[model samples]
Target chain A: MSLDDLYQSIILDHNRRPRNQGPLEGADREVHGHNPLCGDQVTIRLKMDGTTITDVRFEGSGCAISRASASMMTSAVKGRTTAQALTLFDNFHELVTGAPPAGTKLDGNAGTPGMSNASGESTDVKMPRELAAFAGVARFPLRVKCASMAWHALREALVG
Target chain B: MHRSDFPLLAASPGLHYLDSAATTQKPAVVLDAMREFYETSNANPHRGAYELSGRATDRYQAARERVARFFGLGDPDCLIFTRGTTEALNLVAQAWGRRELEPRDEVVITAMDHHANFVPWQQIAIATGARLRICELTPDGRLDMDHMRELIGPRTRVVAFPHVSNALGTVNPVADIVALARDAGALTVCDGAQAAPHMPVHFDTLGVDLYAFSGHKICGPMGIGGLLGRRTVLESLPPWQHGGDMIQVVQDEFSSWNVLPHKFEAGTPNVADAVGLAAAVEYVDGIGLDTILAHERHLLALATDRLAAMDGLTIYGPPAAERSGVLSFTMADVHPHDLATILDADGVCIRAGHHCAQPLMRRLHVPATARASFYLYNDESDVDALMRGLQRAAALFAVAGSASD
Candidate 1:
């Protein structure tokens, strides 16, 4: 609702110095996404070995929210499998769009729908704490697109 | 002008509305006229045989006449009521562009035009297999007339440009462009959406084949605008939309069109909004367009000086003397969306985006810019509020950086 809530220190730091900010060599897939409304654009590249994402990177020019989201997404999904990365993307998207986590009781799923932790406990129906910084985006409807721009490209890069 | 004359401004006291280039706040007189029309004559014009319908028809036609006189058109019938400038431009593209353009023909448009003026021509060119050529802008955002001259050749079928840029507020050289188009035997379509509200527009003297302007940008109701064209040119083109009221006689398979303006207008028109637009025209005329232009220029000068004095701020567009009432700028390391959000918290409304001119954004090498536009209602205090809001955003960002460090 306020600027402080949306522009958290974590978001600003990632925007200032994004991780994996450039191209990924010998990538398996590369996809581009752009928000025509604000002219924010991101190109996401991925390197997949079998069903596992070995590396991921992105490059673009946009607002702090979009840049930070892209930087955070690349860092979160780099070492995870394709399936795990996609699930994480879904959880992050829901967190920013104000939707309940996917495959939760509210989503009418019989079983939890996320990856297991080291203790073999199901961590479904909860967004990773790192992505909680973006929860404020839901209040500013116009900025939801900024938070989701990179994830959209990631979805396309993985699926298509 | 007293802000109390506008109901919305009166209700939202201390609200700084700097987005008038996007749409102006409506005056009480225009609102009252529209309400009175609905209360007194609610019948469908040119439909019923009763006196109410006759009165409605008279009122609608009288609106057309008033709009014509406001734009300096001799024949009211040459002006056709439309949904807005976008629809008017689309009408020209579909009706005129489809018929006149052919394969290998060129339709020249500028890089600074709003999407309403750019996209319709681009679509028409694609449909007809004609080439869509774009005129570039100078480094300072003015239209590159030399490049425009080079682009307008014998194959150019039409030249469409904006009278004033919605994004950069660059006042184009209309007479020169019109003369070049005429010499090249190309029809000229001037998108006057930004011009009519800020200055006096004479459609006939401009020598354009067609001119389009919206009502909402001129302090009138939305969903209404006017397209002024020469009688011969309007009659030559086929009807863009086919429906009731635009047909003279219809068989099971064939139909003949109506007269000049009516042929372009299909179905029941926006009668109430048209009446509101007429009232808007009268209201501005009462204040004198020249005076409004001067007031806006003064505001623009004051705002430009203040913005220029700011650290790490870059203002877009030509100088104040050459432009209208728009001021687009960018602050150091701060996105326009962030600036707009900060300004909104202080009750200052501004537009921060490509302003529907993405091509110009690319030309400027910026993703987007924050724009503050002035109108009749905006004064010096509004500009001061904008500056204060921007300063607050800068201070916040600076503090956040230092805290993180």
Candidate 2:
């Protein structure tokens, strides 16, 4: 895979102008994630309105993949229910790692986020199209951690 | 100067490996020696009555002598074979630190030290109830001499520092630091992982009581390294680990430890890699460390000049004159990992991360830096490739930045 595939225009844009890049006000759940190999750190703040996440923000220093993923994560999960956010996490995990999410049977998406599976069942929680830009990360195994760092933090926040 | 000596470099003409500070590519001669040892002299040393074991014992002992001579150590007994610098340092910190340090005693290490040199002392200090004092760095990343003087005071029991900074390529003044530690009546320990490979190092003349280095960084095999220490200092410390070869005799009641180097080398040692490391030592000595140093300095100078000329790029540490072969830098708006990935696509390898020196990274005030370290195998072309890759990254980021805005 070429560099453009990993650093898609969307990724660069998100990296250049990361979205929701500060601590959420009155955050109920906050979790910090670190990639020890690359020293990429992400602190995710979520303002929970009961089960639904009303606001999400991430602040940290990371490479393009990680920072962009975190920015997109906040945008993706802001108004999502805790369960839906976890489903999205499962979908996103499969997209980058080429591995099925443990204990979560991905609906119809074949772990490809938006792509159709043989069963052709539609996933209730689909990954945002912009998040699919990280699909190429599967080819670069070392970068799977970078692409999944923020998502991992999100999962930790919601699950906890 | 001798790129062809390394088979991987010779095979892949387009590939540029700039992460030698992490581990150097071994030359053909070193590989051949290792293969020869396994093929002919593979046996457990010192246990059997067979000739092969004797041969293995001889080769392993001979390798120790060769490594000792390479470091300019007069006595081979003072050198203990370790897996790498980390193990050697841990040995000193645990064995010596535990024995000597008391509550309120101070262990001084520099901010520029790699984790191998830093964490061991920190842990030892914590375990022994001793205070760990960190010597700060100057703006250019050299050790602060005045701070060094202040840190090594009456309570200071041990002082550990790196001979060269792995992240910043800062060549520290070992003699000056040793002098301060000596005046304070503290035992001096030097981490020579970066220095042993790049330049001439005289372990005996440096006046450090203990020095640790890895073989892989010096063109030798992995899982093999050495710690050079003063014989008296090494003898005073009890064995940190107890195992097969390190014991003199095992009684039902108690056990006695083996002699100098063997007492520290617990397990059935890495004999083949030891033989291979000796071959590597011989290969490096044949090339002449002065020649290697000169060649690396030229490459460092060229890279520094070209990188400094690039827009929005910052080079860390002292100028090229004071540094060894390492060159760490960061491009504005591009994270070091991004720079590394872009460079990887161009077949120019580099190291990007905290470099296992998170304290130093905190000191530098950057999360991490992109490091393109050169070695004897590298030449002007590698630097050209690195520059080209940086330009490409800059161009891509510029377009992306404007489009996003």
Among all candidates shown, the one with the greatest DockQ: 2
Clashes of 2: 0
The runs of at least 3 residues in candidate 2 whose Cα sits more than 4 Å from the true structure, single-residue gaps closed, are A106-123
Q: For residues B189-276, what per-residue lDDT tens digits would candidate 1 score against the true structure?
A: 9999999999999888889999999999999999999899999999899999999899999999999999978898899988999999
Q: List the residue pairs that clash in candidate 1.
A: none
> How accurate locally is residue B204 in candidate 1, as Cα lDDT from 0 to 100?
82
DockQ of 2: 0.81
Per model, state how many residue pairs clash. 0, 0
Deviating ranges (above 4 Å) for candidate 1: A101-127, B403-405
lDDT of 2 by residue, A1-160 (tens): 6998898999999999999998677889899999898899999998888778898999999999999999998899888777668778887888898987777654434334454323443335656788889998998888999989998998888766
**How well does candidate 1 match the true structure, expressed as C-alpha RMSD?**
2.7
* Candidate 2 lDDT, B1-405, residue by residue in tens: 689999999999889999999999999999999999999999999888999999999999999999999999999999999999999999999888888889999999999989999999999888989999999999988999999888889899889999999999999888888888889999999999999999989988889999999999999999999899988898988999999988998999999999988899888889999999999999999989999899999999999999999999999999998999999999999999999999999899999999999999998999999999988889999999999999999998999999978
Winner by TM-score: 2
**Distance from true location, Cα of B398 in model 1, Å:** 2.7
